[model samples]
Target: MRKLETRTIVVASHNAGKITEIADLIAPFGFAAKSAAELAFDEPDETGTTFEENAAIKALASAKASGLPALSDDSGLMIDALNGAPGVYTANWAERDDGTRDFAMAMEKVQKALQEQGAEKPQERTARFVSVLCLAWPDGHTEFFRGEVEGTIAWPPRGTAGFGYDPIFQPEGHKRTFGEMTAHEKHGWKPGETQALSHRARAFKQFVETCLEG
Candidate 1:
């Protein structure tokens, strides 16, 4: 098989965090990843019902508009205690309130629901972060991959390294929250690079290997 050319691949999102993750993941694969904002592409509505569909929609929109191969991802945190709430709606769930309140709200909702059920919080409040990536070409065809990392939610938040709910999320086998690590520190992958295990990283890694470089 021919190697992927060193062409530009546009990532379909305005979020700096997502763009950074995609750029890092695709950089080693010889693709010069750029964000939609860099290309001046308008944001496409993510009206799809599932993460995969949303990713596809965004990918196609960006690919067609930018006239280049495009990658898009939709990711979220799903707490089993909340019956997988804030799944696809992760961003919007926090839209009406301060970003800092999201985790607290999630925790309160879970606790309240548990109380209503007369069931105590499970010893292990299992939760998982899920990421779905879609790669689209101008021809309208698309490829997809998914990844997940399971963990538990910590109360009152933790360090301030990451954005969003990172302060309250603790991956299994790790004592530090995502918010506690710097961007480089999280991606460093020394003894405690939690970002390497994130859903986005895992999914992008798979996409890079199987779709971009394989």
Candidate 2:
């Protein structure tokens, strides 16, 4: 078992939602998490071809830049109908004309593409959100964890709570979309909650158990 020696760690991401969730998860371990944005850390190019590689790139970049332990994640939706397209390029698919990412537009594009391919049924829309977490130390030691949540894509995107493709993703055994769940509901203490069901949460759980709790 390995343990992190730092009290203050950097979350190597600019996404506020990601930063917030990660901060919450590590709080119990007596870690004071800070976002790379807060530290004005320059965003590094994510040139990796896989989620784990990308996560490691970001984590190492931040760790080296800040001289502190850094945690980073690469997560995205992978649609079977699309042959796992938009996997690493998920965010790229959501880029709008205004240079901002919009999940609504991204979802619309997905539906349009699927429709073009004659995929209309829920079963045909099978997909999953995959997350890979990487923890890196300034000295170059690194760890990785991966997790995924299977679901089907729902048309007419539902919910308003979660960010990204949450509105259109319906987890298996659940009628409601992730976007419909409140923060507390999404990350609640109970089993089957988002904290338990979410890919990021699952990956972070492994991180906690293997690194923080050791």
Candidate 3:
């Protein structure tokens, strides 16, 4: 098993929320995680068609630019009723005329589209959030991990704790939406807690087991 030699790792993303989540996950491993924005690394264009490809692209770009190991993730909500639409274009779906992505608007668009498809019942609105994480070394070696959480879309959106589609996503076996859960509840501060059920959390767990833990 290979272990990281550096005390710092770059999180190749401009999203503050993503960086925070990743940093928290990796904090216990005795590594300092810095965001690309904090390091002044230019954001790379994600031209890949799949989550894994995009994650690798970003991770590699940051690693090459910063001369440090970097981590990146690409995630989206995949609605079964929509035939997995807006998969790679999840953020794009929320782009406004001003070119800013509004997740609330995006969630509304998803609901409207489902209604158009005659998916009136909660059972028909089945969906899952998929996340892919890639860790790229400055030497160009990379490792990938993926995670998913099944859920149903809730109407009128609920909660305000989480970002993006959290308000609308009610994880299986949970009565409350993800947006309702605190950071600790969503990510599981304690062991043996199945309640920590975010897609990003799941992916990070895999990375820890496969790459960080020997």
Candidate 4:
């Protein structure tokens, strides 16, 4: 079926960084994008089992709530050695609250696990960041796209540009890590650049392409 035109877009997330990224992505296309926070939308329970499910749930909820086309993204770090663990629980792998261990704690667990396995060296620890984005429309329509960044884990974390696992993730073919690179440097997408290589960027690019085609 032919997709209808979407004039206004809603991103169902309150994360400033995410909102900024999405806005930057949509700006080039001349689309007006708004965040859930701006609309004062309540955070929906992410009861889905996987990234895709969670993304769809959020997108649908937002679309229904705002009555406008909505988009959502669910992403996490999947470690090969951990059996893809932290895949869906990337946000809450460690602490719960006062003892809450955020991404930093998650990294600590990774390090400890590696030490236990006697493979703490950079060469021994490999990981990838994966992101899945879902788009939902008011008329019960939806679509999905995924992106990933493969890289080795770095100890002690480096830089501070990107958030979450960025400091610890050193992308493939690059000597510096994501957190190490400036935002401008990281967003320098050359022509023919594939968004599938970047976890969030890939998904957003795919969504944009799909929208244009639709």
The candidate that achieves the highest lDDT relative to the unseen native structure? 3
RMSD of 2: 2.2
Report the candidate with higher lDDT, 2 versus 3. 3
Q: List model 1 lDDT by residue over 104-164, tens digit each.
A: 5654555465456554443446688899988888878888889887777766578866666
Give the worst 10-residue stretch by lDDT in candidate 3.
187-196
What's the true lDDT of residue 211 in model 4? 66
What is candidate 3's lDDT per residue for 101-193, written digit by digit as tens? 799999999999999999989899999999999999988899998989999999989999878888999998889898899887777543344
**Model 4 C-alpha lDDT per residue in residues 1-214, reported as the tens digit of each score:** 3343866889888767777766766676667888999999998888887899989888888899999989888988887777787788887775557854577787788778767777776667788888888889877688888888788888888997877777888888888888898765555442356533457776776666676654
Q: How far in Å is the alpha carbon of 197 misplaced in model 4?
A: 4.4
Q: Name the lDDT of candidate 4.
A: 0.77
Pairs of colliding residues, candidate 4: 195-202
What is the clash count for each candidate, in the order shown?
A: 2, 0, 0, 1
Q: Estimate, for each residue in 112-145, the C-alpha lDDT of model 2 and write its tens digit.
A: 9899878999999999999999999998999999
- Candidates sorted by lDDT, best first: 3, 2, 4, 1
Instruction: List the pairs of residues colliding in candidate 2.
Output: none
C-alpha lDDT score of every prediction, in listed order:
0.73, 0.86, 0.87, 0.77
Provide the global lDDT of candidate 1 against the true structure: 0.73
Point out where model 2 deviates above 4 Å. Answer: 188-195
Q: Which of candidates 2 and 4 reaches a greater lDDT?
A: 2
The C-alpha local distance difference test score for the whole of candidate 2 amounts to 0.86
